[model samples]
Target: MTQLTLDTRSISRGDGLTDQAYKVIRDAILSRRLAPGTRLSIPELSRQLDISRSPVREAIARIEYEGLAESVSHRGAVVVEIGLDELVAIYDVREVLEGLAARLATRAADDAFIDVLERNWQAHRDAVEADDVEQHMKLDAAFHRHIREGSGNLRLSENLRQLQGQIRVAMTTTVARRGGMPAALAEHRSLIDAIRGGDPATAEQVAREHITRLRESLHDAASAERHHNNERRKP
Candidate 1:
């Protein structure tokens, strides 16, 4: 299976073995190298990473907590599949929380964080221009991370951080069908402007609107997929 094909080089030597194992497995899920329902075998992963099963087990436990994987009855852990309803539900809560984060960040964000946001925006634009989808995905997450951190609410930041695994899974599974990178970038730009202007209401509005549009796009994709499946069944 693709999940078994771990590239050890990707794991940073500076981190602990468990963190290294966690990152490799997590990246595989986010990058779709390990598609939904793939079984994550501890022995197999340990063999590939040339490490003991202890860290690999710990990593899988963490992935489970992050909602990327689940403990099957007898199958141990497997990558999770998010249905359209659940996906929409996640975004529903995210829209409100992210809106609040942006609202709080508007006044709380300092020059350094703003500078980081600006740099991230520029890098994200470059990634899009170059058609580097992987880099763009990373930058997209970074943009949100920076904003949430700037909110100065540790609880909120932790909450969003927990949501990230599912968010990444959703993005990977649906991004191809969504196909509106430029539109997303524009929304990010608007969000940046609102935060920079220190306009709490505008910032919240922009952030909420951004997530709402994403939810809409997912619905559109699901409809199209259903239509295609129905056409196939018509014969």
Candidate 2:
């Protein structure tokens, strides 16, 4: 197990310990700083974060609810691993919600909204050019989130946030396999054009296709990783 030192000074009395701990752990998990299957020790985490084990335990419980961590009988809490079935399921959900978000966003988005989307898409492209996978992930997330917000459906937006957590895990696997960002950025550009043109059908089609391609790329990457790991284990 890898240990991380949390900044105690960053912890404040305002939001309570659990919330602060939750945010710290959640961000690490999402950003892939804490990779999947990493065993989490409450005592070690409590000492590192300079908090009580109760709050650390509470934070871990919330992570479990978010599907980012799992509790084992004797192993305690560990970051959840992305299985093939889980990956497929997550992409399937994204395809539906993203398609709906694009369709709804087209119905109500103003020129300003489109402009924001375009700017975010450009940022993603720039990140890709720089070969900054982390920045590319952040910008890519921003682009999709912008669409969800522009959709004008609060419930849909909330649902998309929940769905995004699962998709992010799969994305980490994909990034490990496919090292380039141009193809994904180009797909984003295509989707943006469809949405900006106010063509709901085209927007939906593009969104679906984009997610489908992501799913395929992630699957290939995961398979390759498995093969590599298997080879490493061979005598």
Q: What's model 2's overall lDDT?
A: 0.81
| Candidate 1, residue 60: lDDT | 97
Q: What lDDT score is found at residue 2 in candidate 2?
A: 71
* Local distance difference test scores for all models: 0.85, 0.81
Per-residue CA lDDT of model 1 for 161-220, tens digit only, reads: 878778777653444545566767888999998888889999999999988988887777
Residue pairs with backbone overlap in model 2: none
Sliding window of 10 residues with minimal summed lDDT for model 2: 171-180
Angstrom error at residue 107, model 2 = 2.1
lDDT tens readout by residue for model 2, 1-235: 5765454566776558999998888777777677777787889888888778999999999988878888888998998887776787788788889999999998887889989988898788778878898898788889889989989999999888867886675445455544447877887888788887889999888888878877777667667878988999999
Name every residue pair that clashes in candidate 1: none
C-alpha positional error of residue 108 in candidate 1 after TM-score superposition, expressed in Å: 1.2
TM, every model: 0.85, 0.81
